[model samples]
Every structure is written in C-alpha cells, then in structure tokens.
Target chain A: MTVTLAIDCMGGDHGPSVTIPAALHFLRADRKARIILVGRTEAIEPHLGTALAEFGERLRVHRASEVVGMDEPPAQAMRSKKDSSMRVAVDLVKSGDAQAAVSAGNTGALMAISRFVLKTLPGIDRPAICSTLPTLRGQTHVLDLGANVDCSPEHLLQFAIMGAMLVAAVEHNERPSVGLLNIGEEEIKGNETVKQAGELLRKSGLNFYGNVEGNDIYKGTVDVVVCDGFVGNVALKTSEGLAQMLATFLREQFSRNWMTKLAAIFAMSALKGFKHKVDSRRYNGASLLGLRGVVVKSHGSADAFAFEQAIWRAAEAARNRLIERITERMERERSAA
Target chain B: MTVTLAIDCMGGDHGPSVTIPAALHFLRADRKARIILVGRTEAIEPHLGTALAEFGERLRVHRASEVVGMDEPPAQAMRSKKDSSMRVAVDLVKSGDAQAAVSAGNTGALMAISRFVLKTLPGIDRPAICSTLPTLRGQTHVLDLGANVDCSPEHLLQFAIMGAMLVAAVEHNERPSVGLLNIGEEEIKGNETVKQAGELLRKSGLNFYGNVEGNDIYKGTVDVVVCDGFVGNVALKTSEGLAQMLATFLREQFSRNWMTKLAAIFAMSALKGFKHKVDSRRYNGASLLGLRGVVVKSHGSADAFAFEQAIWRAAEAARNRLIERITERMERERSAA
Candidate 1:
C-alpha cells in the first residue's frame, strides 16, 4: 500500500530549517512515500522552495493558522491552538489522507492532541510513549517513557503486549522478550506494583522475562522493557545526561595538551567509529504506541538527519500495519481471557 | 569528637576479603577513627592477622553467630539472622558504641534492620537513600534512591528537607539548593505528585530550585535532586549501565588496530585521568538519610577502596552530626508551621 506522512513542520527548536530539509531528505530516500508538510505557508515556502519545484506534487503543504510553542502546557494549548500545525498533522492521520504523523513539537501537547484526535486503540486504556535506543548487542525498546506516570500493574502488562506486538510487527520478531523494570530480579523483589505486574506478565501470552533493573536496559537482555511512565522518563533522561557528560569529557580530554591532542588526531578514525555506534541521533524516533494511527516523535533539538530518521520510523510502522497487529493481539488476549 | 564506625565484615560479595581490608585502610588513613568489625571470628581473624599486630587496639572485632545471604529477603533475614553481621553492626550504632554503621550486604535487609533498630529521626516518616555522585560541575547528592517507591508530595518534601540538611551539614553550605527531579523543567509539568511537591518546595524554607530533568543530575545544576525511590533507582542504575557501555566501547575502539593502540598508549595518562574523574568507586557511599543514626550503603561488588570511601562518608556524616542537624531543621520547620 502507498504510504503518506503528516509533518508538523512549524514545531521543534529550529522549526522549518530542520523539518523542511528532513522532509526533502526523506522524500529523496523513499520513492513511494509522500509527505504533507503542515505549517504556516510563509515559513514553509522559503525552506521548501527549490525542493518543492523539483518534487512537484509528491511534496505538498497543508497550511495551519497557529503554532504550538514548545513551552505551552497541553490542556491550554489544546483549547487555544486548536488550528495549530501539530493538531492539523494529527488530523491528517485521523482522516484517510495520511497513514502516520511525525512531530517535534511539545511532547505533552503532541500526546494529548494525538490521544484526543486519533484516540486509543481497542482494548488499550492509555497510549504510551515507546522509544528505541542503541545497545551493545543491537537495539532495545523501552516503553511508557513519560505518558502515564501512575500506571497500574494491568497497565504495565498491557504495555508489554503492545510493545511486543510493535516489535514483532516492525522487526519481524516472532515473540520479542519483554522485561519488567524493577529494583531487583527476584520474584518478590520490587515494590508491590512491580511484583504484581511480574505475576501477570508470567501468565501473559507474550514472551515475558522476569524482573530487570536500570542496568539491564543497556545490557540488552531483553527486546522490550516495561515500566511506569515516571521511572521510564527518569531512566531515559538520566541516560541522556550521562551520555552528554561522557562526550563532554572526551572532547575536553582530547584538547587537554599537545601530547593528548596529537594522540587524538592519530586515534581519530577509531573514535569516529565509536561515536557512530553511540550517537543518539541514529535512534531518534519515539513511537506513541496504543494509538489507533502511527505517530512518531522526533526530539525537539534533533538535526535534519535525526528528524529524517523519525520520518523513516513512522513510514516503516505504517507499512508494517503496526496498528492492526496491536489491535489483533489485544483482541486475541481478551478472547483468551 | 572522635568518630567510630561499625562494619559488617561478613557482608558483600567477597565478605571479609573486601570489608576487612577496607576497615584496615580506613584505620590507617584516619588515626582518630576506630572500627567495630562484626562478623564470625574465624572469617575476620585470617584477614586481620598482621594488621592487628601493627594497629593494636585501633581495630577490634565483635563476633556475630550468623550471616545474611545476599539473596535473602529482608523480612526473612531479619527474623532468622538477628545476630548476623549486618544486624549487629547496626546494633553497635543503636547501643552508642559506634557513631555510624557501614554495610555492603543486601540493601533491603540493611535498610529493614536499620529502620527497625536505629529508627527514623524526629519529623521524618521514612529513611531516604541519599548519595553523592560525580557531576560535570562537581558532586551532587540524589536521594530516595530505591527506598520508598510510592512517595507522596509530603514524602518528597521530607526528602527535600532531609537532603538539604545532609548537604548543609557535611558540605557546610549555608543554604544548599534542592531540585525536584521531574520529566520536564516547567512548573506545570510532571505527574500529580511531582507537581504538588513542586508547590510545596516553592513555599518551604529551603533553597528550592524549580524542576530539573535527568541530565541535571550530571550537570550539577543543584546540590540535591529530590525524586521518589522508584524513579531515583532507575535513574541511578541506568546511568551505571550507560557508563559501562561507554567504557566498553572506548576499550573496543582503542584495541581496534595497532595504529589505534599506539595512539591509546600516547593518550594513556589523559584517559586515566578521565577514568579517575568519572570513577564510580570514588563516590561509593549512599547515605540512608532520616535515620536517628548514620548508615552508609556501599555497592555490593565494591572493592577495598570503594568500601573505604563508604566508611569515610559515614565518619564524615557522624563527625558533622548529620542526624542532629536534620533533627534541628525538622524541629525548626515544624515550629514555624
């Protein structure tokens, strides 16, 4: 089936400078894919001028009146910026025009607007944010990144099923293993909620590994890690902070003295390879799972390549029928129960 | 006043192999400090043989009948291993024979036994696990690191108060700044508990910085970050995992080829310095704050140097009268309210 993506081009730190270039790059890469760039007409026109001339009908713009500020709260923005670029992008997905939507706007606003418009899939109580990051082995997906702060044990189990279904559909894994993030690995270890979730997961149809800790996320012991939004958000942000610190140290070390500077020059290629492996930009998209339509969030400060990666993620998820697969899994689990 | 520390010599992965040497190193470093090494006499004797001859009465052993297994649950271990090394070390603190207690045993058991015996200080409901971590600016103390999973706004405020007091006492800061760890930096962001905690912190007498994300931990934007134990634990562990991953990648890169190896040799000293800066062992101790007596939790797999750091932390807290300072602050806040 032909695929289409709606882009909230007026979102993120750089706005049109980043999103328009990213859209052009994605269009160049995927022949069958088309994108509806949603933003103010004046802002979109300048960035997409020559590219739009070349791509013709394949790249088009859907004008929206307002833009959601990065700092605005979700509920207020929802009431005021009803015709915002982020809202229009989600609306395209809600209608039959686009298969998936991509945004680099305010995360809370995006989640709220998407949930309001697209709505949660059948048998799912809430839409969770799932993101994939690089691991030593390959890549691992962690979910409920910041969507639902106070998740019940049942919510965690549902996150597992949804995460597994997404991985199974997107990566073609038959049964992706899911790990319940907790303080300790034993059956009786974590707090009451985690312990109860473990019991529910053991009986769930998905491949459920026992309890995992913060360290296990990077260890790549499982394909998916399930946790409440609060823990997942902290873990994700902490990793981001540590990675930034290490990178800063590396840069400082290389510039310390002439001897180290000279050594850094010689070791440039090796360091380059290592940097590529751990680069956060390489894995930029965070899927808003459990939504009826495919939606991927690009980091607010992501560069062109990173934003393009978000587009690719959204396109792939749509092509693989991720929503249908998740729906089927939910229905199967419910019927069995 | 001289400070004395009680050590659970039979705890940790290596038992006396780690604890006995740590105690000896600590004794050698601080002449005014003394240790009560509690464990099986046989297990303690072999490691302390020649050191006792040189150090004489400075180092002494307090024998215990049983040992707590690393895998044993806290409640089970508490009932069965009443005379265990960990319990007796805490008992030394309770009996006023030692100013503080240090352990590398099962964290849950140590916390349970400490709470049951030493008890919480006045105006504090629960003990929070607080620790100093190396940051880009310097070191920051983060609290409630896996101690209380379901923290209310009131609990977070208490943690903020306890963390501020500890930092003020040990670091001698007049009014140390505290941050409420949140998913976002905005006032309106975060879940209900965090939002409520923010409001409380704003009104509280402490130096309250608004909200900070995970990266702020390493960025050292504030002296202390207050989060629930669940989020704090995940953030701590996730950082550990990422640090491990980065180190592994660096090693792999440096060994890739002879040219890279040659470059690594030249940059060895710079790399070593960087390693020393981010070294987890240097920041090994986690203070169980809000307790009537000082308790420091060392990493389970810590070596002598790491364990010694834990002892140093405990001694410093004891000397500074952390508990008394916390009590005074609590009393002040309560009276004002």
Candidate 2:
C-alpha cells in the first residue's frame, strides 16, 4: 500500500531551503511512502534538483499560488491566503488524495486550516495538539498544547476523552489513566474552572486519575495529562526553555576549564548519546488529534533530521489508524450514553 | 540599626535539624545580624549547643505553642493553629521586632498567615511570590509564582509593577523592563487575560517590554517577567523538572561506560560550577511581595547550604528595604493617579 503524505512545502522560516531537502530525504528513505509537495512550483523547483527525478512517479507537486506568512493573523490568513500551502496540503488530506498532511508553518494557521478543511470527528469539540514528552518513567502524552487557551470545563472533559483515546490507540494502553493538571493534587485545590472540570471528569468515567500537580508531568504518573491550552502551552514552553538552557549551560561548563575539557573527552560518547536521546528535534512532530484525517505539525525550527523523524511519526499514526480508533471510541461513547 | 530575622524554627521537613543549624551558621557568619528563632523552646534548645553561649543576647526565642502540619489546609491551619511557628514568625515581622521573616513550612499556610498578620500593602489587591532564576545573563525575577492562581488583568498589572520594583531594589536593575508572559511575543497573541493585561501594561507608563514567550524566560529578555499564578507556577515547576531531567540524563550518560567516566573526571570542575550556578537551592528563597513586611519562603527540602542561602537572601532583602521600596512605589502610584 502506497502512503501519500501532503507536505506544506512553503511553511516555516527557511521554507524550501529546509522543506525541499527534508521531503527528498523522506522519499529516498521510505520506498512505501509517496510525497505530494504542495506549494508554488517555482519556489520548490529550484531546490528539488536531480534528486526529484529519482523518485519518479512516487513524487508529485501541487501548486499553491498563495503562501501564508508566519506573522499573519490566523483569521486574516485563512480568509486572504485561500490557496496557501497549508490550506492546499490540508485539502489534499480532506479529499482522500493523501493519507496524512504535514506542516511546520504558523501553528494557529495550520490548526485553523486543518479544522476548516478536514472538520472535526463526530464527538470531538475541539482539535487538540498532543505531544509526547520523555519522562522519568518513560513517556506521557500532554494534550491541548495550544489549541484552545480559554477552555471551559466541557472543553477540558472533551480533551481528556480525546487524549485518552489517542494514548490508548497509539500508545497501546488498555485503560490509560487521565490526570487533570492543577495547582495541587488534591481535589479541593484548584481554581473554579478546575473544580468544575474535576467534577465533569469524574462523571465522564474515562479512567480519571484525579488532579496532578505541575511537578507530576515528569513523574509520568498518568498516561494522559489534560489541561487548557494556556496552562499546557506554558508548561510545554517552560520545559523547552529549561532543556535548551541546560544544554547550553553544559556546553559552556564543558569548555570552561582544562579538567572539564578532559572530562568532556572521556564522557564524549556518553554525552553524545545523552544529547541524542533528549534532542527535541528527534521528537519534533505532534499529532493534531480530533481531526477527521491524520495531521501532524512538525516543530517550526525542525531541521532535515527532525523532519525525517516527523515523516516516521506520520507513518506510525497512519499505521496505527489513529483516526479510525478515535471514531470508533466516539461511536462507542455515543452508544453507551 | 540591628536587623533581626524571625526564623520559623519548627518548620520544614527536618525542622530544627536544618533550621537551627542554619540559624547558628548565619549568626556566626554575620555579627551585625540578630536571629529570632520562633518555635517551641524545647524543640530549638537541643539543636543550639556551644553557639548558644556565644550569641546568647543576639539569638532570642519566641515561644509558639502550636505547630501547623504540612498536610493541613491553608485556611484551617491559619485559623486553628494560630500559635504555629509560621504565624509566630509573621507576628514578629508585624510587631517590628524583626526586619523580616523566613519559613519552610506549608507554602499556602505561610501565605495565609503572613497576609493575616502583616496585611497587604496599601493599594495592592493581593500578595505575590517572586523568585530569582539563574539565567545565562544573570538572575531574573518571575512574579506571582504561586500566589493567586486566578488573576484579573488589573491584578497582573499590579504583579508586573511589584516585580519591576523587586528587580530594581533586589537585582539592582535601574529601570528593568517588564515583560508579560504569553504564548507568543506578538502583542495580539495569548488568551483574553493576557490581551487585556497587555493593553493595561502599555498605558500604565511602566517600563513595559511587551509580550514575552516561554523560551525567552531564561534568555533574560526582561528583568521581570509577570504572569498569573497558574502560568507562573507551571513555568517555574516545568523549568525545574526539565533541569532535573537534563541533569539526570547527563549523569546517566557520563556513567554508562569507562571512557565516559574518564571524560567525566576532566569535565568535573566545569560541570560542578555549572551545577552550582543553576542549583535552585543556591537561590531557594522566594519573597512574599505586596505584603507590609518582608517574608521569604525557603524550599521545604532545603539542606544546611540551602538554608544558609535563604538566610542570606532574607538579609539582603532586609538590607535592600524591599518592603519599604514597594510601599513607596505603591504610594507614588496612588498619588499619581
């Protein structure tokens, strides 16, 4: 079976300078995968070179006359940049031409375009951005990374259900424990929204694990951690900032003195392996759950290696039939209700 | 002009095992500083051996009959355990017997006890907790770390002002630019609360630097970064978790093989220095801002070294007249309005 991935070729900062090379790398690496590069032909052609000829019929281009700027407002971009690369890529997934769509563009624009073009699954109220974090125990999925910042209790309940479904389908957890991120672990400890959400989650009967504090994210106490976009975004970004800071600090420390330099040489292999394990780019892409079709958003600053990882991730999502599982779970939920 | 700090002798996990020894260390280190140990007399006397004779007059004790358990709710603890060490420490600050107070007890209980005793500073709606983070550039102050979880735009503006005052007084930033923590750097980005806060901050005539993203926290883009307690707490904890994870990953990598262990020896000095710089315990104390008196909350898990750092932080805050500066700033704002 040929798995076609629709690429938003003109997304991100460096555009085709990064995306074109990344697409070619994916195509060369995976024989079972086909690439549908969606963007302006002129912009993508120069970067394609002779590598584009090697793929032959497996590779194709869909010209998108318009491109959305990273700084453009989401609503304005959606209205004005109707034929933008992001829209074209999402449309391909919508029209069944591609099994999945990938973009490293303005996250808001990608989400908006995906939502408008692909539509939400039957019972999913809002589409959530779910990403896996390497924790002390293993890995945990955190949802609504920045989909809906001002989420209500109902929205949170929906996020919890969707996040659990995704974790169950992709992570193969039989009954994934869901935790609501709160200031304190106790039921009585959060703001009004959390209080209401806690009640709703309890009633939802979705393997609710009660409230988890900020520190619990690394502990991996639960399979799914649910929160509004505002809190989730802050948590995600803070983790990213701290990781970057630590890596930079280590580099500086290793170069500070002769002893440290010697230590660095002795620990070079270990350090490299450690860096490889924790590299954000290695896990650069996140699945946009609740969409009718499989859609993944690669990190904005993803390099070719990171982009390649994203391709693998997209393949995994497709192979797992994540959307089908979610639909089935929603249908079951409806019937149970 | 003897500066006295009321130490909560019966607080923290180890209680007097850590606090008494720490107080003795502080007393021996600084002759000009007076230490007022507030707790049960029987509990503190055993920890002070020879040091008691050397500073008999300088080291005083205030008898507090009750103890607040770490598990008790904040309100319940404050109401029922009026004579708790935390409350007694705050009472000393309020009564003018001490220049400041320090505690490692329940954070919520301390906040409530301090507010109940010292009262909020004029024109301040609520108190905020500000802590210093060691960044590459220097230390940065993040306000409302866990004070008010759900804050309004006006409350955030007040937090920004208080944070700026703190940076100026404590960090010595002459005109520290304050940044509103948001999902993106764009002024138009973030949720409704951030949007409203941005508008108010721009017109408040403060040295506002506009919206700052999560990645910019450690980059030292602004001297003071202000946000609601929920976001701030998540950011603080997430940064901590990431730092710990990175440290763990590095340790595991360095010890995995013999070659790496040899390299680790060479990198020991630089790595130790880096650890020293980023260690939270080295900067463990948090100031309870917007209160009429200075109160620094140390981490409950602090050791002797961390406690010493907290003592130094308290003395520095006292010497800098942080409370006085905040009071003056608030008065100026009122008069200007």
Top of the candidates by lDDT: 1
lDDT of 1 by residue, A1-337 (tens): 5699999999999999999999999899898999999999999998876887888878889999999999888998788888999999999999979999999999999999999999999989999999997777889999989999888898998899889988987899979999999987778767888999998899888888889999999889899999999789889988888888888888888889898898788888778988998988989999999999999999999999999999999999999989999999889888877
How far is each candidate from the true structure, as Cα RMSD in Å? 1.9, 2.0
Q: What is the TM-score of chain A alone in each candidate?
A: 0.98, 0.93
Candidate 2 C-alpha lDDT tens digits along A69-185: 887788988888889999999999989999899888988888988998899999888999988888778878898898888888888887887888777766778689999998878
Worst 10 residues of 2 chain B by lDDT: B328-337
Q: Give the Å shift of residue B95 in candidate 1.
A: 1.6
DockQ of each: 0.74, 0.68
Cand. 2 Cα-lDDT: 0.85
Candidate 2 scores a chain A TM-score of: 0.93
**What local distance difference test score does each model get?**
0.91, 0.85
Q: Model 2 segments beyond 4 Å from truth?
A: A46-56, A334-337
